[model samples]
Target: MPAKKTKPTWTDVKKNLASFDNPGLIALLHDLYTASKDNQAFLHTRFGLGDDVLKPYKATLTRWLWPNWLKNQNTSVTTAKKAIADYKKAVGQPDGLAELMVFYCEQAAAFSSDVGLDDESYYDALVRMFEQALKTIAALPEQQRPALWTRLDQVRRLGHQVGYGISTSMDELLIEYGVDARRSR
Candidate 1:
């Protein structure tokens, strides 16, 4: 009887490639990209070769922050959550996720005033954005984390003036993040 053949796993392939030289690695990548459309697309997006690298992400934030017709609190919260997840999947990896979260905070801030929205519902939605951002800061590099926190502090100050900062949870989150909620300025 013939012996069973095991399929080649990614671990096996990675081990084999451990001895690859620069040119060999490049050649292997080129071959892999050529062999699979998925590989090509991944390389394009992953290496910033694709145009509109941040287009979809920008659009996602815009849609929630500034809806085409009217601003909806529920939609904003849902969209912001989805945008955070999308950012994690597409851009956030080892170092740059904070930028995306900060961008979301900015959008949420602008979103507060743009539609003349200053109610608790909308503010709560905005707070949700801040919460997600705060949660993500731990994953960011030390150099990047403070900048995001600074932006978030600014948002908290502004949101407080506008009524979104009324959420006790928001204040708690600020303290939890080691932010001086009293000196948001």
Candidate 2:
């Protein structure tokens, strides 16, 4: 009988990597850096090498969340959210994560408002990310909180323009976070 074939795992790859010397590892890293834009972004973010490490991640978010409908582009919340997850995995800086989350909320809300998207699932995802942005921003330092809050406040206004009770949901979240919805308006 033929032997069964199995998928290779990270452990298998790591075991293989255990044999490499420093120069070999550097060569492998160079190969990875040149292999793909994603690899380059990950390496840049991991080492804090770029002038704006978040730029690639933001571009991914913009592409997935706020696509150009005239060009037949489609939105993918999963892909947009994956960019945030990828950034988190690269460094998980709290302020950076908050920025990306707020930016995610902003892109999604703006798209919904502009397109008049009537998808229930999309609104649900937007509201969820709104709440998440609030949570993440709330955990940041008091000084850091203001700018993110202002951005989310803009998102809340966009939600109102979206016209699916998204603004109401965001208002409730703002109240829960002690932001005073009436004051935020």
Candidate 3:
């Protein structure tokens, strides 16, 4: 009779890693970075290891998310949404995706504040971005959510202070996320 074969697990891999010294671990990571484009991109972006943080990603997202670049962009919101989706898919981490989402909203909020774009429609796209970000949270462990929530709240506070309108306020969306908003007097 042939012996049964089983797949190795992450725990098994982690256990194996304990035998390596610092140089060995670094060498392993080097090998992983060389093994695949996805691994290289993940490490580069996560650690900002590249000459440009956006070097690991498609330029579409960097152009859409950054203010100086996005200011001159003629792209549609759908294109921006697709850029984010592509980034998230490539990175394979919800936390990374959430960071991109928050970064976009923060840029949009600043743009809105600068031009005083009407709160209602101006923040509509941002709300959609927020909603999409919310979708990604389900893939993350519970403990990781609070930081994301805090960043989202920061955007909301910025919008509220800028007088964009009640629709753009943080409480309504936070409620949807099951987080009670702490109102300021």
Candidate 4:
């Protein structure tokens, strides 16, 4: 009887990613390229990417946004700090403060992309960075997690408003994400 084949392990996955000249990498790149092309086509067809009508206010939205949203919420500062620090470490940063800076930068880039200020490559890069930042933010303690998640939702809502003229209010955005903004505050 033939032996059953085991699934590829995490080490195998890492090795695959490390093989820069591998055919698998070429296939993965092609998949990503095609997906990006499809995404751009959809955006252009549905949202009219050329029109710079609604510009999202990213700076004001991100400034103290986390703290402000977290204020009056039930969260331990120690846990929040520790989670931020861990996230920084995971992402190869020196400290949580630096991670916060990177997070804000990614948010700013997302805003720029939503506003049609970024080219296809830049926009795609920013979106990937934003997703990484979001994953880092999600590793926070449950009590302290709402603040960062709320800020992210607000950013997405603002992006939607800019891109699609969808008037998604802060409260509505929070509700949509199942985050009780009132409780979070």
Candidate 5:
């Protein structure tokens, strides 16, 4: 008789936190930021990019961020400050601004939560910080503006799949972009 194959153990599944470096963490932060921003843009555009059209997305953003504000415990002070600034910069534009603000607030809240900020005060601070970031992004040059906006659309679509608790492999995203998955990565 053939020998039975053994299943992988939990000990094999666990990753050593110490082996993980700052760059990986920073990259994750960047990815999360991009995903949130993209999702925000997608929501705004899908609903018509008008002030009134942003209500649902805004509400959703608040819901997503509020929990993060209550859970993260290792976020850096400087990074949190920068995120707020970006949020303010992105908020005052005629197109999709409010949605971007929502994204920024969510990011800030996540960072704060990660850094051990679990109080209502942190949530309030994140709101104010995100507002500031929105104001700043609204001031960019028109030529440079479309890139971020466009990328946000892509991000939003992918985010929707993630938000729905659907798992999308990187290959799927690559295929959507018309890249040959095996070669692309």
Candidate 6:
């Protein structure tokens, strides 16, 4: 009987990588960076070498969350969420992660408001992201918390306009976090 072939895993890849010289590794990374924009973004983010590391991630979120209707673009919560996951993998900086999450909620809410979206799943995603943003923001320093919370407050207002109990759920989450969502600021 023929032996079964095993698929290559990270261990195999790491062993191969360990054999490469500095120049060889550089060449391999160059090839990978050239192979895809995602790789380029990942490299730039991992090294903190870009003026705005979050730009590519934000563009992806905007594309998936607030697709151009007239251009026949389609919304994709999964793809939008994937951009956040990718950013997390590259750097996972708390401020950057919070910014991306808040931006996601903003874009999704804006799309729902502008397009009058009636999809329950979309609203559910928006609400879930809102809570996630709140939770992430809570972990940041006190000085950073105010601005992010203010932005989420704007998202909550947009949710009210969207209906489907989005605003109600947001209010409850804010209370759970001890936040005065309607406070004068």
Q: What TM-score, over all chains together, does every model reach?
A: 0.59, 0.92, 0.56, 0.34, 0.25, 0.97
Q: Please list the C-alpha lDDT of all candidates, in the order they appear.
A: 0.66, 0.89, 0.65, 0.45, 0.44, 0.93
Predicted candidate 1 versus true structure: per-residue lDDT over 20-101, tens digit per residue: 9999999998998899654554465577776755555666777776666533334466765675566566445644455556
lDDT score of model 4?
0.45
Q: Report the CA-based lDDT of candidate 3 relative to the real structure.
A: 0.65
What local lDDT does model 4 show for residue 75? 19
Model 2 global lDDT (CA atoms, 0 to 1)? 0.89
CA displacement after TM-score superposition, residue 48 of candidate 3 (Å):
11
Residue-level lDDT tens digits of model 2 in 77-135: 89999999999999989999999999999999988888888788888988998888889
lDDT of candidate 5 over 36-144, digit per residue (tens)? 7654544454435666644544544444443343455343434434433343344534445534454645454344434444445444444354333334444655454
**Could you arrange the candidates by lDDT from highest to lowest?**
6, 2, 1, 3, 4, 5
Q: Write the per-residue lDDT of candidate 4 for residues 1-185, one digit (tens) a residue.
A: 99997998998888868967678777775676578643333334234354521111122224322233335532122333333343334333322433453455345444454444424443343344345545554455666666666555555555564443222433343454466544654
Q: For this target, which candidate reaches the highest lDDT against the unseen true structure? A: 6
> Relative to the unseen true structure, what is the C-alpha lDDT of residue 18 in candidate 3, on a scale of 0 to 100?
100
TM-score ranking from best to worst?
A: 6, 2, 1, 3, 4, 5
- Mind giving the per-residue lDDT tens digits that candidate 6 earns over 11-124? 999999999999999999999999999999999999998699999999999999999989999999999999999999999999999999999999999999999998899899
RMSD of each: 6.9, 1.9, 9.4, 17.5, 20.9, 1.1
Candidate 6 regions with alpha-carbon error over 4 angstroms? 182-184
Error of 2 at 135 (Å): 1.3
Best by TM-score: 6
In candidate 1, residue 47 scores what lDDT? Answer: 73
